[model samples]
Target: MYKSTLALAVAVGVLAQQANAAGFVEDSKLSLSSRTMYFDNDNRDVKRDARGRNGDNRESGQGFKLDYISGFTEGVVGFGIDAQALWGIHLDGGKGHHPDNSSFIPSDTDGSAVSQWGRFGANAKARFSKTEAHFGSALAPNLPILVSNDGRLLPQTFEGGTIQSKEIDSLTLNAGQFTHAMGRASSNRTGLSVAGGTQDSNKFQFAGGDWKVSKDLTLQYYYSNLEDFYKQHFLGLVHVLPIADDQSFKTDLRYFDSSSDGKNGEAGYQFSNNGGYAKNTGEIDNKTWSAMFTYTLGGHAFLLGHQQIGDDGGFVWLNQGSVVDDNGRNEGAGGASFYLFTDSMINQFARAGENTTFGQYSYDFARLGVPGLKTSISYLRGDDIRNKSGDGSYNEWERDARIDYVIQEGTFKGLGTSLRHGVYRGSGEAGADMDQTRLIFNYTYSFM
Candidate 1:
């Protein structure tokens, strides 16, 4: 905590030195965003916890985020800073409804929900030509190798230094190294690690880039290494074809190759293989590929995709599930997200020897005279999922639907509302059957 505070102080001192610069204060922006959410999860298989209660969770919470972004100082080498403050208030849900392993809310010492929590972060940045560098604890990266998770009240953050360069025409390069992560539901930061690994790894390095070859085609490649955990490489291609004035077809292909690194598979550095079969238990050795195609006409979109997991092992990504506090309590870093269409609302249909097929349909109500409304529904089914026992395979499926609307005109013109629900079922070693729902209200006020 002191380190973060010192970093922020240094950044502020630097910014104060250039407070009178032409573009620094004139182009700064400040905004506050508010979100109220209600979440419900029902486990159909109903397993008893230590307290002998069913595995069902329901909660409501309110979150507020304040952001300040400053424009770069006027110079050949510009300097700036970005800061954020986040606060979460638990509105409802008692011990009976709060599971011990829940990642939606922080837990108290007595295994109950905490009344409230909050955190603050800042980023010190510099820009030279088309290249930019940022170092801070508020980094939320959206890359093919690492995606910051914001599925809950607050967003997950990383403590890292990153650089991006777009000096070359039609190309962008990115590289970064992160040491710690702040979970969405907690105020504390923990070192990085993967699922089923009890020990933490302080180093995660990645480098990647995107190259736009033409008006409608792009290619991407990235490499990531988690110290003592695993190393992964990613390749992606995207293309779009116009069919008519209001119609187009898009194609996206992604592939990943992962292997064990350092002491992976050692005592405290084991991988879970996503709770499925691993050719060698606790080892990372896998190859996965996916393809997605979409057709759009008017206000309607149809999407279809297929994904295959290699028989060697399951997919892998940066996860902090095993990072705990000194008292052995969870630090709320259990949940993470990867870059894949299989990353659905309920389950990530990724496991060894699994094949998944998914589809989605969406519509923009603007075509029917309602400019602020839209809806989408999707379904995914996975089969041939290798069981841990290696005797046979299992199958699972999930269906999700959501609707969103934003007030277009009025005092609450920018207010938005969303409702989403998902149902998941599976057999064999797959996870428990469950149904989940979420309702959210969001609004942002700018104080530029």
Candidate 2:
């Protein structure tokens, strides 16, 4: 990644005059965004700290982001650049509230919340026809195999080179090799790894494509592998049928197959199977599939879905650890997302032998003359969770509610507010009952 970026920078010098004279500055874009968030989570069965205190983990903070994107230069091989700057400030998490799970704020060496933190990244690009190549330290990719998480105050970023091509209409191709990742928390960047691994892997390769077979049908296939950890394959299908002018039916199907690779089962590099059943103790071996259907009419939409985790183990995905090292004390580097709708506000029921049934109902108040108001409620139940003991089983469930509103056409236009709450409960220790809530305010301004 660094070498590629250097090469692009050298190219910029040779063509500096033509590049700037071209469409670069004329087509450039600048944007600034701000978000204020309040988060609260109560652990039903909390464990005491060294100070013998256990309470709801509550925190509030604000985030600011700035982005600049320059358009490609004129001629066959055009050049451009993209950059991001992020800043986070701690508002109100007191001394006792500091924990590894509090990823929204930076921490002092002693684990106390820092006053402020920030990071900046830039990536250079070259484009030709319908193909573009990006090389840099900040890559946000949204693909069937990988999804850059933006669920927190800051977004997770990767360092690598990616090529996207659409030379053939209706089909898009993507290939990339990412070596390092910047977690949502720390300003530093670290190598990639799976959850529970103490070491980091520098190599992650992926290739995929999306093929639109028809106006209403599309197909996707992707392959991703984290060196010495795991390799995975994904397949997805989506189809939509127009029932009426204001009504439609949608179907989505997804599947994943994963297995251990290289040093996955060897001592220091062993994988944990993540509190789920595994035919082999310290390895990744699992298959997961899900199907979902939705029907929408006027202001209402209903979604129903089911998912099954193969008896071997839970599902898997990339989880790069923290950048500021504390001898590996902090785990779950930062926020992450998967392709599954089941990757909800709280729990992700990817445990082995687990079968989940879920449903959601949403309403858009636009039909009632409230164009920017929306509300939704969802429920998920997962049973037949195979515990590590293999003979034992557990079940868990979660309920989530959300409401969002945006100021449509007023002085506050473009301002958005969102509220989300979730409750989760389970039968065994595998599940920890808890309640979580988040309130967010967002606003953005674009500079052309």
Candidate 3:
């Protein structure tokens, strides 16, 4: 993986340097960050019986990241390059914590720990007025149908080409077709598939646009079709309403409808009744919608949100997965883990048929004394779960609290510290009750 990434990076750099050297400009910037993380999973009985659940082990680790961006030249057509370098050292990840799990890192034949792994990718890009194109291996490109998965330590990157444009004012357009995916680990590129099904298609395509109608309102529409998988459409609206002087409310509404396409075309994948043997008959139609409102007053803010998924299928999207890094979470990998509908205290509250509702209150203590500190508490409850088989009903609840501080001035103005905790409990198909905590300290430095 390392050698391949290096060769690709060099090729991109060489090509960019030679592209119409007369009519272009050369500018470069770099940013780097370091993070340490501690992880622990103590789910006793639930560790074994949980369907599709991976292993749970206690571990701690540290990682470093470097990001670089180069500016294009001036002309009708310009070219540039972007690069990211990642390195991680396992401070404490051992066989006990992850226990037979190869998701975080690749496992050897005898099942033992390796020192560490490094990842890097570069993109060659060209721009023509309001249009631009990028080709390379990199982060999960943001697309509706085949969103990247970020469920583990690092994010998934893909090797492909993408194009975007904004020729019309107040209107933005984007489209990308990917041919290969570099899983979060191994640095190896693999053929793209839908949820690990037998059907394999190397190409994933998407197109979308967003438009702002007024100062405070905007509308969005996009279409995504993954070969042999599913086709999706997304519509979104965002608006802000002034209720008072310093108190205003912002609303974010999003809806998505998806169905199978191509070889896996609509009504393509099917199976017999009576819990017959499952087959790669493909999937059926699925729809999901969510709305959230937030209000701010004085030094405090309040938020409320609700989300629902229609029956007949599970929620789907291009997931980029999650990571344990302190820089923050990346969602472009391929992991499906998410806290409930509440704050960041992800427990499983999005069970079938259940309507999940959440409320949160946040306070900025800096207004009183400190200048870079804040805290928040939130709760989410889901009831009326209809279960996967549409039989029984259940209820679940979660409470989460987070405190974060960032240096407000001087040399450490951007340094951050955070503490997070959560408790979750539920009845019926909501799964087992559990508690988890996370502590993070982060800092970033930019170079230009």
Candidate 4:
């Protein structure tokens, strides 16, 4: 015990010295969250066989997270570390309350909750000039060909290394290779790949760049390839058009094209035929695009957005799915916050048929009275899901809402809380219609 205490003290002293010299230090924060998820199928009477293995279900759960970010070293090349610890407990729901298809929470063979589970990981990073690189066991990632799945109770994490650079003007470059993954509700690390793909080749590679042409215009390009899986490319543009003295409209455009590669590449897959699982051999071509605009007036912001997917195949890939939370910036989170366009449903252009559309509206309560508070509501509907053999088409729709708050001042300054709700319905497909809600509360205490 004395040795442990001494070690901790020495570690703290080193962190303090580093923080003072390099503007970085070892810091910690914690958050608590709760979620009440419900799954119901409106078309249950249509076909009992379509209910999947889990049938229809509803359940409630609670989660916790502890995070630490270390300060960089005082030198020409600074070094630092990031660590996260997480756990979740089942508050409600049992075997009968959960869909057999959803593994949001693990269970015993007898259909009872496994009680609880926990996970921990750390990443080491080095920075020089405008570039930084980190490698370790953490969030698997979210890219074009290997996007992680967060539709369950937790976000997934991966083991890998990533590098980013922005030394030249407005151009930013990113590259990485991931080797393994851990699900949001799991602690053990496993080989990386799609949900039903082979685990033999554990490496997934990606690289990309983003360039800013003007103050209001930007361009982006990225490429990702999953070994024995698929390859994807993304192109995007963002422009802010000045409308009037205090009004401007922002437009976000994105496109993705993907196909099988290597052993899983177009010709390779087709040649082997059943060599790949899920009858997913051969190649797939697909694209997804979105455009949005936001106008602000007297603290009131109105936003409208639309997205479409060209039905060529299922959605593209990024990385294997996991439960570790991530943002547009690729930083990990344990609570309920997520990046834009990463909906629980309609992800990866999975909606069947041929086309999809979604719209959203948001407001800042600060204009009304509460400063540090915001809310948003959105709706999405997708159709034309082309089933194999071209027999029929499937459709889906979702209604989602979010509310968040942060402390403005006082001793509790910087504390934050959030709530998210989503209602999803699907028909003419093998998927289910369901409702889900997430509640998260977070507090960060910085020891400067």
The clash numbers for all candidates, in the given order, read: 0, 0, 35, 31
Query: Tell me, what's the RMSD of every candidate?
Result: 1.3, 1.8, 5.9, 7.2
Encode model 4's per-residue lDDT on 112-179: one tens digit a residue.
55567778776767789889987777554555334565555555777778998999998988899877
- Give the winner by TM-score: 1
Note the Cα lDDT for every prediction shown: 0.91, 0.84, 0.64, 0.59
lDDT tens digits, residues 1-448, model 3? 4654575677676765665664333466788986666655555336552334445555665667788877776667777877878776666664455544445554444343345766787787888998988878874565434556443345577777788888988888888877667665444456565443433466777788878888888888888766766688888888998878878899988787877666653342221111111123335366668789999997899999998765545544442212212323221223433222332455644434557888899999867998889999998887766554565367778888989999989987898887877777778656567676666667778976
Query: TM-score order of candidates, best first?
Result: 1, 2, 3, 4
Candidate 2: give the clashing pairs.
none
* TM-score comparison, 2 vs 3, better candidate: 2
For candidate 2, report its TM-score: 0.96
Per-residue lDDT of candidate 1, residues 1-448 (tens digit) = 4776687788789889998898888999999999999989999997787787686879999999999999999999999999999999999995588876768888788778889999988899999999999999899999999999988899899998999999999999999999888999899888888889888898999999999999899999999999999999999999999999989999999999999999999999999988998989999999999999999999999999999999988899998748666657676677899999999888998899989999999999999999999999999999999988763479999999999999999899899999999999999678899999999999999999
The parts of candidate 1 lying over 4 Å away from their true place are 1-8
Ranking by lDDT: 1, 2, 3, 4
Compute the lDDT of residue 244 as modeled in candidate 4: 78
